[model samples]
Target: MSVCRQAARQWSPFSLGNMPLYRVCGIFALLSVGLISFTPPCDGGNILVFPVDGSHWINMKILLEELHARGHTMTVIRASTSWYIPEKSPLFTSITIELDEALEDFFELYLQEHMRLQREGGSAFAFFKITKDFMSMLSTAHLMWSEALGKILDDKTMIKSLMDSQYDVLLTDPAMAPGVLLAKYLKLPLVLNVRWITSGEGHFAIAPTPLSYIPVPGSGLTDKMTFMQRIKNLFFYSTVVIQQKFMVGPHYDAICDKYFEGGCDVISLLQEADIWLFRSDYVFEFPRPTMPNIVYIGGFQCKPAQPLPADLEEFVQSAGEHGVIIMTLGTLVNALPKEVTDEIASVFAKLPQKVIWRHKGERPSTLGNNTLIVDWMPQKDLLGHPQTKVFIAHGGTNGVQEAIYYGVPVLGIPLFFDQFDNLLRLQERGAAKIIQLGEVNEHRLEQELKELLFEKCYRENIQRLSRLHRDQPITPMDQAIFWVEFVMRHKGAPHLRTEAYKMPWYSYYNVDVLLVLLTAVAVSLYSVFVLVRCLCCRSRRKPKTKQH
Candidate 1:
């Protein structure tokens, strides 16, 4: 700098050397060229996705989008009767399969009946009835998937083509098992985008889940269980076992026999997955044992709020100090039963706060001027909004995760499946309240809403959760993407997966070893005892002679 100053003083024209912008541009250009020259280009991997329809497809689609953005080629296998998974998409090329039966009505009926039984207070008769219904539903769904996959397998051309594609990893949600079966048939590395599987939650399938803490889905129990709670957990677990062995297993068993050299095990296949992008997090989920390959990417689908449409903004602004309450029952059921909706609507009508409800059913007569009923609302955007106060939810994983992400306290009306369990976790932490379907009346719902709205603790606790959830070193989405890429970079992640799944039950638990050791010790003791007795007898026999 001193030399430059001296030169500047000697020649005024030389002062143009102070033009650092030109120098900065030259340096930036050099760095850019260097980076371009040295940095290895992205080698896109081929990914095959087999996703279940409905909300499961939604999750798979998001993951596919991220993989697509990262330059990976994606192909999604969807069903012909799928209501949600679009045949045409910019994200991935979809291969639609033909289905003999459509399952939308079947699931809808099951949910309706389940909700009705829950509303009937879940009596013993109701419990049995619901169990029968669930099994029937489970059987039909699996049988459909099994047959669909059989058709695909029978088509030599399609099977050959999929194998020819040489996909790096086969990504699937194990809610149904065709994908796992297909992956095995194709000999591709498998990655599961999962929470629910055929049997129960994915954790129960792969992790060492003890009923002492890990509550079964639909069992409104938490990690800290009372004695009776443990029994209830077992009972719920029994339901899951019945679900697996009786309802879901036989259909897949047939498929396993048909294609696999030996009978295939869906649960075992699930355990063999290279990576499990589990849709849960410790921040939201109760602490439990997790496998190495299981990546908790909870709330990954949630993003920052975007601008609301004009009318929504105006309605939200109109709420002012009272703020708005938003309600949505995830993807499956657009509306609850008439009586339940009426009860909820009546409560919302009386509230000072404005309400935006995503209800597709007939409008309630009790719906008030303060409430706005729409077919759909931008859920995450509303949750992120400053004016949004409380979220009324059906306790879907996505909704509960989003609630945690946005720090919104929930007033949950869990209808079926894992909904109650999801809300139970939030309630255990005092971040939310659950009102069961049986007890959902105007008086009860109104009371719950008032408490959720007025209570400071609920807001504070959930916000604390939000902070912890946001405090991660890497975002959940990025972590998920990294593991997926990690699996692709290395053909499969067998090192991360446990070999215990391959072991027989006795071997896995070391029962055989324990029995062998026990037998050796017992035989040694018995032999020593017999020898000592003989020695004593000999001594006794000789003692008479010695005394003489």
Candidate 2:
């Protein structure tokens, strides 16, 4: 049969008219039941995804794909960043803001000024001042992005347009705090997907309690902080609280009042979120104490192996027995100081292994025979290859996950941010050694390389962790999809929420104990005073009676 004729015969309602009326009605009923069965329970619902670029969004893409496969729809709203290379798809529609362009321009101007100052032989004090100024500028740029996002969200027309679509769930990066308000206003299920670790305040509604708590995973050592450290931590938390209150809290409150009947607390809005998803694995971010509503669905960004590029394949093929060392500092911190680059080159020169370093822009002059510099690399593919042995990395979470996925040991040279914490976790797990940025000399680099290359324990430990990581009942992607669907199926699982949301800070910390002690002391002092007064009165009454 011709294709069109076959489709017509299958779908034509007029053809069914020839049958008995009862038979036609039964056919229509059966068709309706089939249609309902095929359709997903949810409608053409929407999801608002922010920071829609980078590895963070990769997992989100996977979830969207799953939902799409199941016959649902989503809309992504995000800031533009180069990290997210666009893949053309009809199912996905993206709304991107130009925040990255502004940030790029600001950083370039700041860099040019700082470089000029350095070229002018600026003093140490002057250099410090310039650095501080640059940091302030960066912070200001971040704040501006947040404010612009807030303005977009606050527009009545924009909110109504988005609401008209009747979105079922709002998924946002924890870095974008404005999402909480949008979710609250719409009265939708807000799922905060945390891409990185931070205090559970601000955008990180899914993180563990004691919001700013840092876990020293696998350390197997827990001790109380010294008094000074406790004081310092308290001061740091207070500062963060103050900054976030001004920058995010007030705007959040305003948005909530306009949308939520002017009757909601900002923190209550976050606490009432439908669910929280973290991108960290339990093995990596172990010892995390989170409520039932918070789910750890890490490694969703990881993928099975793919074929390596021809040039990379040939490069590895050329390196016979010594194998290859892959080095990267991630995408953001591409600019390494000249001293560090030179030291890395020197160490690579001494090693027998062939080194492939992903260095952007101009190459250093110290290139040696066994070394090759490339602007980029297939990091996971290389890690999976048998010829690839060691990863010298900056300890970014994605890089670390890839290394662990392939069971390749790492020599971490962490520079800043969570790099230190990641390296510490790896070191505790006995799968890696760290080279602090300040101490990245040729000697130390060489020694660390030697240990990673020759040490059997590092390899064994990594392989062990890889086994644990892989032994899960489902892939991280499957687990993530399940939880996301669970939320949709259940219509917001408020029962998973904890009592932490109800208590004040003082009460949560048992400051009520101090209050009780103080009250007892006051009562004791008052009793003593009453007793003394009674004795004085008795003495005075006795003297009066004697006189009479």
Candidate 3:
């Protein structure tokens, strides 16, 4: 037979038109799905972002840029209180508002107080003192924004423009409560970005937090707590709630009343938010209660390190087989006291591993020849490098997430804010050592670094966490984008939201259930007592009748 006839004979039964009607429909359906699978998603919408300016911006920058890349239009409201960089992309819009000087003073004072506390050996009262200072700082920041908020609302032209923007969703950081009000003003679905690992009110807004295991942020307590520690944790959360109610709540309400249309309370408004994106992952954290609205996009902020510049590459490569240690206190901590800096340098000099310290001021005299000091370093690159063995960090969320992403053990020199709490949690994970700046001496620094560098357990634990962190089927970026779009596609993700939004505190906590149970027990006890008394009376009456 000819080649054409043989081919026709072999394929005749599978020909599309020659097949049954149902089979033809199935074949076309398969083709349709294949075409749709490769097709890019196009359901983009206007997304308004409100990230607190200055260092807070860095936390959300990667996610914001990724949103823009995925074709969502973003409008950012930047405050002049901190540094604001206009996004280079055309898809982004920036509106700068002049903020009060209170924020700047707050940070300066915070650093001074933090250093003083660290220098003084920690006491039983340390947690109380630190919590008070942190709350005070937060209060000061809110007052500054309150001043700027009045101006923002007074600007009729700007208000008119923003109102007309017709944004589909409002994304705001938990640090920026004004952003919550802005969402209400725009009448858009509110999505929160909790940049910190734990925010008291933020978690409470989503679901009830059990303090037994979930350490209070900034409490200087870990996930594994003794009975005393749990009591302390309870006290920490109680104090936080009290402060939020008395101090932070009023400020937020006042701002919302002035700016938002409906003028709801901050807590109530927060509950109605569509989704909460936390800067935390389960691998580095204890398993805790979470609702469908909660999503952990922890390492989403971290990216593959770009190629290091020529000088940096040469310096890191020079370490050879010994590897390098990247030490950075992050952008917020611009400089440390010279004495403390000298202590760190002294320890670095003795180690065989090379040190790349990110410091702005003049180099310390005790710094070794193996050490490389720079005004700025590629922190992510250095941490991600194959030869990068350990990271000496301030335990900031950004730095810690990067270390976890790359499976590098950390020698944490905690200063202030959540740094102490972060290191405490990581220490519980067995992948980090917390070196309080106050107690940091030559011996402590040298000993801690040696343990972190040489210890097999540290590396093994971190590597285990690294695998879990990286073993996700979907990239963090994809997961984040998927949820964001899921919200948009489904119109604020009502299905994913919890009934906690609708329930009162008493009902949600099952106080009503407890009350009912108590009532039922009381009724049952009364019935039993009556029956026993009646039986005793009947027995006594029978004896009297027999005597008669």
| Per-residue lDDT of model 3, residues 61-137, tens digit only | 77887888888888888765555456444658888888657365668788877687768777858656776887787
Preferred candidate (TM-score higher): 2 or 3: 3
Candidate 1 lDDT, tens digit per residue, 64-183? 888899999999999989989989989889899999877897788788888888888968999888878877887888899999999999999998899888899999999999999998
Write out the backbone clash pairs for model 3.
118-438
Cα-based lDDT for every prediction: 0.89, 0.69, 0.79
Q: Candidate 3, residue 334: CA error in Å?
A: 1.3
TM-score of 1: 0.93
Cα lDDT over the full model 3: 0.79
Task: State each candidate's clash count.
Answer: 0, 0, 1
- Give the winner by lDDT: 1
Ranking of predictions according to TM-score: 1, 3, 2
Q: Which residue pairs collide in model 2, if any?
A: none
